[model samples]
Target: MIHLLRNLALVSIVLIAAGCDRIGAPVRVDDAWANATPAGATVAAVYMKITTKDADTLLSATTTVADHIEMHTNSEQNGMMQMRPLSNVPLEAGEPFTFAPGGAHFMLVELRQPLTAGLRFPMTLQFQHAPAQTVQVQVVELGSR
Candidate 1:
């Protein structure tokens, strides 16, 4: 009976793993782009649309282009615009989230090198329930829409 139970458990695990889309697909990401940083610039921002298959929390992000990445949301404080770092952001299943300019975005803090147009890099998104997804971000020239 123990051997039979063990086989059943293994099959269940395989079924569950197969239910989730492979890495980078369970959390669907679209329109990932970043702005080209000017010479000597130390920071940059990336914008993207994300939709998770399951209700989850976006816990963190990592990338090779920056010293560190922070999840940020813009707010007004004392009549001044300010951006604050967020510890985590919640996501509703099948609901799309946008990280755009003048709103919530991933701040690439302390960039190792200035981002240039046509450059591409990977940013991995860590979630509470979904497997981490690595998305490619395309850099666009600054001052362009």
Candidate 2:
């Protein structure tokens, strides 16, 4: 009886793992761009919307172009703009989250290389319940108001 129970448990685990794979198709990226900055002593922000069909979570991000990639959110403190890193963000089922400037965004800091206009960089994002998705981000020149 014990051996039979062990086999059942193993089968259950496999079923759960298989179900998770079909939970979401993939993460969709829209309107992605890296703003251009002046040469030397500058920082830039990335704006994009990550969407999924079912529930999922963003684990982490990696980019060879930047030294560090972080998930950040913009908040107003004492009438000043403040940004903080978030450990994780929930992706609701069939819901789209907007990541834009002065809001929830991804900050690429300490760029090892300069980000010039009309350049494309590769970035990879790992998801907790979905597969790791790599995306290409295009650099755009600074827009005049």
Candidate 3:
């Protein structure tokens, strides 16, 4: 009886640990923000951390804030930072992918209008293996961060 009880307890612990992997939903966004920029002739980048519980890919994104939204990454070109567009953002289960300045980021180009503080914009993100999600992001003025 003692041995049977011990085995059952061990099995319960293993089941709980395995369940953790599937408990995380498809995708989650954290610390999403567009870098502060000047009034005119300014380009901005949005940063965030994307987490996926299952293998997925970021297909595309759309928003009215910019004429074009592209996934980009900064690479060293002759020791200088060179930004290049990515084919797609890859996500792995139980992994966090961060999009920050000087790294993997989102290029919000051709600003339709200047982004001012206290302004929030609607943006949508589409995933290859998950449903499209929309998020509201606020604009931070220069000198704010």
Residue range 1-145, candidate 3, lDDT tens digits: 9999999999999998888755965678877787566868546788788887788999888888899788999999898988788989889986899987679988888988777777888778899998887877777776666
Task: Name the best candidate (by TM-score).
Answer: 1
Residue runs of model 2 more than 4 Å from their true location after superposition: 1-24
**What TM-score does each of the candidates earn?**
0.82, 0.78, 0.79
Q: Rank the candidates by lDDT, best first.
A: 1, 3, 2
lDDT of 2 by residue, 11-92 (tens): 9999988886776466777777788767894456777788976689987788888887899999999999988898988998
Positional deviation of residue 85's Cα in model 1 after best superposition, in angstroms: 0.8
TM-score of 3: 0.79
List ranges where model 1 is wrong by over 4 Å.
Answer: 1-25
Instruction: For residues 73-134, write the lDDT of model 1, one tens digit per residue.
Output: 99998999899999999999889999999999999989988899999999999998989989
Angstrom error at residue 103, model 3: 0.6
Cα displacement (angstroms), candidate 2, residue 34, comes to 1.0
Worst 10 residues of 1 by lDDT: 18-27
Worst 10 residues of 3 by lDDT: 35-44
